[model samples]
Target chain A: MIRRSVAVAAAKLTGGLSRRLGFGGGTALPGLVAERIDPEIVSDMAAQLGRGSVLVTGTNGKTTTARLLRGILRSSGLSPVANSAGSNMMRGIAAALAESATWTGDIRQRDRRIGVFEVDEATLPQAVSALRPRAIVFTNLFRDQLDRYGEVEYVGGIWRETIDGLDAKVTVILNADDPSLAALGRRAGLRTLFFGLEDESLAIEKLEHAADARWCSICGRELSYSAIYYGHLGHWRCEGCDTSRPGVEVGITSIETFPEALSLTVSLPNDQTAQFKLPLSGLYNAYNALAAAAAASALGATNHDIERGLRHASATFGRQERLTIEGRDVEVILAKNPAGLNEVLRTITNNGRSENIVFFLNDDIADGRDISWIWDVDFELLSGSLKNVTVSGIRAWDMALRLKYAGFDTFDRVELDTERALRKALTETPEGEPLIVVPTYTAMLDVREMLARWAGKKAFWQED
Target chain B: MAKKLRVAHLYPKLMNIYGDRGNILCLKRRCEERGLDFELDELSVGEKLKSDHYDLIFIGGAQDVDQRRVAGDLREVKGDALREAVENGVVVLAVCGGYQLMGRYYRTAEGAELPGVGLLDMWTIHPGEADKRFIGNIVVEWNGGTLVGFENHGGRTYLGDGARPLGKVVYGFGNNGEDAGEGAARAGVFGTYLHGSLLPKNPKFADHVIQAALSRRYEGIELDEIDDRVEEAAHAAAVQLAMGRSII
Candidate 1:
């Protein structure tokens, strides 16, 4: 106990020093240093939380879902510790857990504290054991970080094993629209709550190019889809087998998406319905809201509490976050994978105005070294009358090539430097027109810091 | 009207991983840009492959499950037709998983031997199961010009003595990590793991295939050169990226 206390104090000191030196977030460094002293520090620390933990994970929307859940939980008068910096590894979770702890290893707000975290898909099993979550939320999974995570089916395999090994008492929250995820509800004697979008009006006319899960997992035959929302999320049924879209306990039946916010009518499991005008934009956000509400409900949050909490939901930093700069509306949407980028493009195209945009692509370790996935995105949809596009970041040329092939004339607008690229894009945009800035994971961080500095907003780590 | 080129995109529904449909799209666009009648046929699993139907054939990469399924479909179903097409001197370009399937066999990391179509005298072996994929931007010296594309593959392909490589590796691990050879090329048949839509960055290579396919049906026909500035710029940028230089 004495050694663990000393280790925690040292970790906290490292984080403080790094932040003071402007090392950027310093969220993982403290936890990494602490783990060197005591490897089991996360499980040990999580043991102290009385309300236990609720884990949110998927290929995308984990960060957004966790943020919404955190807000909803807080509104219900429960204090929860969350990692809102978009960090999900063991180290980041530890940092967030340690921040709410004292130098003497005593957790702050012991009676009401809960751990609400977004975990990486590959690290879900390890995190589930360490956090010991009472409720696990499975958001929709798509083909993401292919070079890093291989195939989505591989991750699903891991998830099945992890789910099988979990405690029977732990509740499972799943997306019924996703066939692989919805199938998890059939696991023997496990408690599962399913959530999905039920409105066929929001269905896309045709499936995107990079969509996956076309074949039935059970029979390996073609799965017929009545409507595909995005990347295999929709009303689907396998003709060969009886498997199909399950009945959702919590569902979003209708959604009105706008440039500023989304209005949704959600059906909860208790046979009650709630209407919320969530301040977040896009159909994807509506799904996140439903997932958050379901997860919060599993933790005993009332329908009133969930609706009240969701009504106040906002973008989780760099996630469809809009800022007005000198009368120009610039929305920063994080695009890390084909599915995520397609959603952002759909949201932008929803306005039907030829969008002036900037795309930042990086090939750093965190961003997936293989940048070939850029081609997987169907960018031809943005060709209606795109005003202009500036491609930037470390792999700026690759992005520019991809856009050019996607039928966008970005040959004369490639900028390798992200800062200069933003300036150029901003300068070229007409007054009052929304300039969309689509960036990968690391690029989003850089763009966020740049925007935050100009607006005097707190850094991500500082805010969380 | 120009000469028609029948193009068969094999297993588009199942084997088009890593955005390889972009390659087919590029082929169609280039053919039409040059005033050629391009007919693209998508052959999925359980579909019969007509040996004489296509002038040029393209096969893309796939994931492990799809690859195994495709290998069986190739062996038990379309193997003879594909072999006949190859022997008939049809211009064919296969990438990554397609390249592996055209070989004698692919020995998986789990020690299972999946049969291949045996068009190329080669075999592939996976080095390890985790984090061993050869993935990155690659530059190759092929067809007397530079070709730049992205490669991500778990198996290392070894060419037998009778086969010839498509190019020498200017960068990245190609074929086997030690051979420094990229792919296998014989006559009008070509195979490589490079699929940044392989041909968009190398219009010359794309044209070479178009010309080869056209020549198979017609005599003394040369494709007119359209302005390749945009394609060349993108190509140069990729080449620069491969050579460890920024294309700002």
Candidate 2:
């Protein structure tokens, strides 16, 4: 107990010093310090939550889904603790718990506290062994950070191992539209609930070029899809083994995508229907909303609570975030993988067209050193839509080459410096026109910091 | 009149884990820019290769499961036709897993030997999971110039007397860390682990491939050069990055 108290105080002091020194958002540092002091810090703090915890993980939609679930839990009169700034590793979870705890290592509102965390794919196993949460929610999986995760199959293999080791009482929340994820849930023999989109009007005839999960997990044959919403997700079945997508307990019956919001009607598991307007847009967020709703239902939240939670949900930082910079309307969308980028392009092109856009690509460890995935992204979707396009970041020339091959005759400018590129893109945009900014993971952080400073807002860590 | 080239992409749906389709896009754009009528055919599982139909063939990387499945299909259905094409000087390019499957065999870390197409006199062995994979930005010296791309592979390959190395590694591990060798080449067939699509940045190498394909129909044909300023810049930047220097 004394060691835990000392660890908490040291972590809080380190985080305060980190923020005062302008080091970063102090998201992962405090957790690092706390772990060095107390190796069991995460497990120790997570145990104090009376309602246990729920883990959300996948390649994409983790942050958004966790944020929405936190809101829903809170709307249900429960206090939820989350890593809200998108720092999603074990250390980030530690920092979030540390920040919420008192110096004496006691959680505030101990009886009502529920740990809500969005963990990285590779870190999920360690997190599960530590937190031992009551429920695990998996969003769709795509080929992301190949250098780090090896491949999608490798991730799935680890997840299967993790699920097999879990207690039978733990509920597994899955996305039914993803064949591999659904298969994982089916084979786990644990309590499982599925959520998916049932709207055919939003389906595409063919799978996108970057779809990753097409093979059947049970039979190893190519799975055929009747309708592909995006990537390899949709109503799919294996011709070889005759295994198909599981029945969805919580499904979206209809969806309406607007420029700034998504209006969706969800059919809950209790035979109750809820209509809510999510302030976030795109079909990806719609999936996140569905996953959150299903997980909330498993956590004993009511339909009214789910509806109100989703209705009041807002965008996480750097994810469909809208800002007015220098009197120019700018929207920052974080895209790191081929499937994610394709969805972003589809959403932007489908709703409203932007004349000026800036693309940032970085090869930092967080962004995956292999930038070849850019070729897999169907940038041809925006072939002739833009009047001015600026490319920047560490691999600006590579992006420029990609655009050239995509039939863009020329670029407005290719700037390696992100700040300069963002400034130039904003200046080139005509008044009253929106400027779209697409950046990788690390590039998004840099751009977000600059934008926050310009907007006279506090740093992300200081926001809440 | 425009000259025509037929390219066959092998196992496009199954073996395309990396950005392998980018190589096809690069080839098509380069051919179209130079007034060559480009035709592409995708050959997946259970698909056979037609004799005298294609001038060039491409196969990309895949995971272990997909690679094992493709190995069976390749040896059973398309082995003889592919060997005949190679003997006839048809240009072939295979990256990563494709490169492993074209060799004699691949010994997995678990002691199982998966047979290859035997197109090259090379074999690969995965030294178990305890060993580190050769993965990073790579720079190589090939054809009197520098070739820069990214390589990620767990199997370490060694070439035999039947094949010559494609290049000497200048930086990063290639083929195997014990050897300075990168890839293998013989009779118009080239195999490597480099998968920065391996063509977009290396325009000179791309031209070499194009020239080799065009030579099949038109002997001593000289190809016109499109502006490659962006391609060259990207290549140099990658090389600089591999050399541990800042690229700006």
Candidate 3:
């Protein structure tokens, strides 16, 4: 325990040094420290706390769920040791653990009640093996990192294999709407909790083929969907296996969409339900909240605490996080894939206001140099109410052209000069309306930096 | 009325990444500049590939699973339609997984092997899954012309004995084979793993394919000139970066 604490502290020092040197790299320094010392230093530090651990992993919604779970745990009056900086890797987790550990290489027992860590999907199997988290929350899996992970089914198979190897005591919370994830719950001896949206009103009439899970995992039959919430995730069933979305233990009933304030009704594990209002938008966020709630219930959090956390929690960076600058409101939403962007488009259109939107696309190394994914995004979801959209970033024109091809009017289309685009988009926004800025990975970082500078808040992610 | 070059984009609805449609646009713009007519026939499944009507046939790459799904349908294609077209001097270009599918067979380590359309004798073999993700500009020397683009594929391809090499490998595993850089027949079909919509980075290669298609119709015909602004500083930077040469 003492050695583990020392290693975490050292990792923290490494992260601090990297930040002090203005190096934005996330895993390089703490990786070195973890390598030199105990390789499982991060997990060991968390284990030393005597508190159970819950890990959340997925392509999207991981960051949002992590933030929600942290708030709920804090509201429950438990000193929760979490990766507050949004760092999910071994070194990042070590740095996070180092922040809470005492100098004597021991977690302060009084300060440690539970730990929640959001892990990268690619690294989940390794981290879960070492951490042996008490519960794991999976939001949904999509076709992300095609160059690295191949396809979504390939990732689904890996997740199943990883979960199968876990100890029988571990609980798994899954999104029942996802065919790939919900199928995992069918296996025996696995303690699984299913959470999803039962609200049929949020479903789209037609399924978008950009990257959807249209086939059933069990029977190899094509899934028949009554409606689609996002790509492939909705009320679906397989005729061959007779498998479908089971009765949701926890469900997102209603989402009251408000500017900077959204509310939802969640069915708690205790049979009683709680209505919580959040300052976030879109149905995807409702799923994020349900995942956090399900994991919190697994962690023994009370309904009251979950309610408070949902209402009191501020938005994390880029997940419908609202930033105010010069009396204009900018809703910074991260749209990495087609499903995410489609949801953003739906949420903005649901507002029924003609507002200027800033769409940022960066074909950076992390953003998948193949920007062809833009063709799959349902930009057609934006109807006549949507005002001019200012495209910006590396592939801004590419995005604009995609929108144009989708039958969107190009009259309001503007080239994406990042600085000028942001300024012009924000300034052109009519008063009393929110401006939506959709950005991919690197573009999200750039917009987050811009917001952080204006809002006078330091970026809390673990990168450096 | 001058006849427009009839082009059929085969298998576009699938196996297109890196915005492969950008290639179609590049071709369209080039043709428009030279006052040459261009009509695109998007022939997906259930659509026939009429060899006599079209001048150029272009196919893009698909994922391994999609490749398997499309393989059976592609085998049903009238080989004579394509082979005859090629025999009579029709232009054909396939990129990435499309290039692999045009060959004999693509075998994966998972024990799954799908038969290729036999447009090319070469075959692709997946030797234990590996992520050969090579980003940024890629340069390849081919037939006195330099082809540059980006490549990200898992399977390595081996060239058949009768095939001619595309170019010398500047970087990455060229075609995944020991000797050949890519699969290219100087006078006929052109196949490579390069993508950034291949032609945008090097218009000369696209032009070669177009000229070959037009030569059969209009002997000694002079196509209109295209002024590619990208051939300026931006492209020079990309070329420098693709080569081992530093821009700084």
Candidate 4:
């Protein structure tokens, strides 16, 4: 107990020092320091949450779903401790827990606290063992950071192993529309609940090039989809073995995507329905909301609480996060992988109001050194719609080349420096029009920092 | 009327990992930009390859499991056709896993040998799970020009005496990393681990592929150079990045 107390104090001190030194978020460092001092820091702190933890994980929408779940938990009168800034590794969870704990390693109001963590796909196994969450929500998986995660199936393999090791009491909330997740839920013996989109209006005619998990897990044969709602996600069934998507407990009956928000009518498990307007757009967010609702409901949040929570839920950082810069609305959307980029493009163009857009493509380690995924994105979707396009970051020329190949003859500007590109993009935007900024993971962080500073707001890590 | 180039994309659905479809898109866009008709045919598992039908054949990389499935189909169904096409000097481009499958055989880390199509006289051996995979931005010297792309592979390939190296490694790991040889090339078939979609940034190499494919039907046709300033800039930037960052 003394050692644990010392570890907590050291971690808090390290976090404060790092924040003061502007070391960028101090999200993972304090946890690293704490773990070195006491290896049992995560399990120790997570045990204090009487309501237990709920882990949200997947390749995409983990942050947003976890944020929404946190909102739902809060609405249900439960105080949730979360790694809210999207630092989702084991150390990030440790940092969030360490920050919540007192110097003596005791969590104040322990019975009321619930750990709401968005864990990384690669770190899910470690997180599950350490946090021992009461519920786990999986958003749809897509090919993301291939250099780090290898392949999508590799992630699925790890997830299967993790789920197989989980206790039977732990609830598993899955996206039934995602064939891979649906298959996982079917195989996993734990208490599982599924959420899916039943609206055929949001379905695409064919699977996009970026779709992964096309093969049925049970039979190893190609699964046929009745409707593909973006990437390999929809009503699917295997012809080889007759395996198919499980019946969804929480399903989106209808989704109406607006210019700035999405109106959804979600059908709950017991024929009860919850209709709410989420202050976010796109079918991806709709999936996130469904995942959140199912997980929250499983964790004992009422239908009214779910509706109220979703209605008041705002955008997570760097994900459709809107900012006002000089009276122009600048929305920053993070587009790291092909599927995510495709969805972002679809959402932005669906409104048909976006004229000025900026793309920042970085090849940093965090952004996956291979920028080849950009080619998989259907940049041709923005062929004639954009009035001005600015390409920036380390691989700005690569993006420019991609846009050129996509049939864009000329770009408004190609700037390597992000700040300069952001300035140029904002300046070129006509008054009263919105400027959409799509950046990779690291690029999004840099852009968000610059935007936050410009908007006279705190840095992402410092905010809440 | 523009001349037509028929392209056969093998296992486009299964073997299309790591943005490899970008290579096909690059080829198609370049052909269209040159006022040539680009015709594409996608062939997947259980599908037989049509001999002498395609001017160019493209096979991208895939996951390990999918690669295993493709290897079986490639050997039983399309092996003879592919080998005959290679012998007939059909322009072929294979990246990463596709390149491995075109070799004589690939020995797994667990020592199980999987037979390949043997279109290229080479073999690959995955040096166990403990050893690091060759992954990152790679720069190579090919055809008296610089070729830049990203390579991520666990298997180390060794070229037999019958095969020739595609390029010399300038930066990053290539082939077995010890040999500094990157990829294998013989006749019109080019097999490499470079998957920055290989052709989009390296427009000259893409043109070489187009030229080789067109020569079979058009005979000594010279491809008109389109504006490649953006491509060249991207290539230069990648080369610079590869040099700046030491990726083993």
Residue lDDT tens for model 3, B55-155: 78887877666566567667776455776777777788888877888788988758688877777778888776654443444667776756766676667
When sorted by TM-score, best at the front, the candidate numbers are 2, 4, 1, 3
Question: What's the TM-score of each model vs. the native?
Answer: 0.96, 0.98, 0.83, 0.98
* Candidate 4 vs. true structure, TM-score: 0.98
The candidates, ranked best first by lDDT, are 4, 2, 1, 3
Candidate 4, residues B100-176: lDDT per residue as tens digits? 99899998778888899888899999988789988888999999999999999999999999898899999889999
lDDT of each: 0.84, 0.88, 0.72, 0.88
Q: What is the TM-score of chain A alone in each candidate?
A: 0.97, 0.97, 0.90, 0.97
- Model 4 ranges with Cα > 4 A deviation: A315-320, A410-412
As a whole number from 0 to 100, the lDDT of residue A335 in candidate 1 is 84
List clashing residue pairs in candidate 3: A392-A416, B15-B61, B61-B98
Query: What is the per-residue lDDT of model 1 for residues A1-464, given as tens digits with 9 covering 90 to 100?
Result: 87678768878998899989988887888888888887888898999998999999998889889999998988888898887787788988888777778997779777799999999999999999888899999998788777777666689889999999989899999998888897777789889998988999999876677678788888888888898888778899999987898898899888887766788999987689989787766778888889999999889999999988887555342333667776677788888888878887887787654479998988777888777777778888798867789999887877776787777767688888888999899888898898888888889989988876665666666664
Best DockQ among the predictions, by candidate number: 4
- What interface Cα RMSD is found for model 1? 2.1
Per-residue CA lDDT of model 3 for A34-70, tens digit only, reads: 5467676765666675667889998788988988888
* lDDT per residue as tens, model 2, A137-254: 9998899878887777789999999998999989999999998799888763689999999997999789888998898888888899888999998999999999999999999999
Between 1 and 3, whose lDDT is larger? 1
lDDT of 4 by residue, A128-237 (tens): 99889898898988998888876777899999999888899999999888888887786535799989999988788888989999998878899898888888889999
lDDT of 3 at A459: 63
